[model samples]
Target: MVGWLIDAIKKDYQPPISKVKVGKFNDYVQREYDFDKLEKKLLGWE
Candidate 1:
């Protein structure tokens, strides 16, 4: 399921910014929102 989602995203998603900026944004969001926790929740672990 997660692999399919990632594959779909890779097929259909396009970022408006550069890879560096995307990485920075991901880091910021992870730090700000505890994204690992969010992922666990999404995967029904919490």
Candidate 2:
């Protein structure tokens, strides 16, 4: 019963947005490193 309901919902659902673009690998790595440094500072890491 629950499985049937979930399947029906999945069949009917549609995403509103389309087209996701990712930046270059070097840019992503730099951004991630910056975020990690900020997070560590927030957590009081040395």
| Model 2 misplacement above 4 A | 1-33
Each model's C-alpha lDDT? 0.77, 0.77
Worst 10 residues of 2 by lDDT: 24-33
Estimate, for each residue in 1-46, the C-alpha lDDT of model 1 and write its tens digit: 9998899788996657655533554554333688899999999999
How far in Å is the alpha carbon of 22 misplaced in model 2? 25
Q: Could you tell me the C-alpha RMSD of candidate 1 in Å? A: 17.9
Clashing pairs in 1: none
The deviation in Å at residue 39 for candidate 1 is 0.2
> Would you estimate the TM-scores of all the predictions?
0.31, 0.27
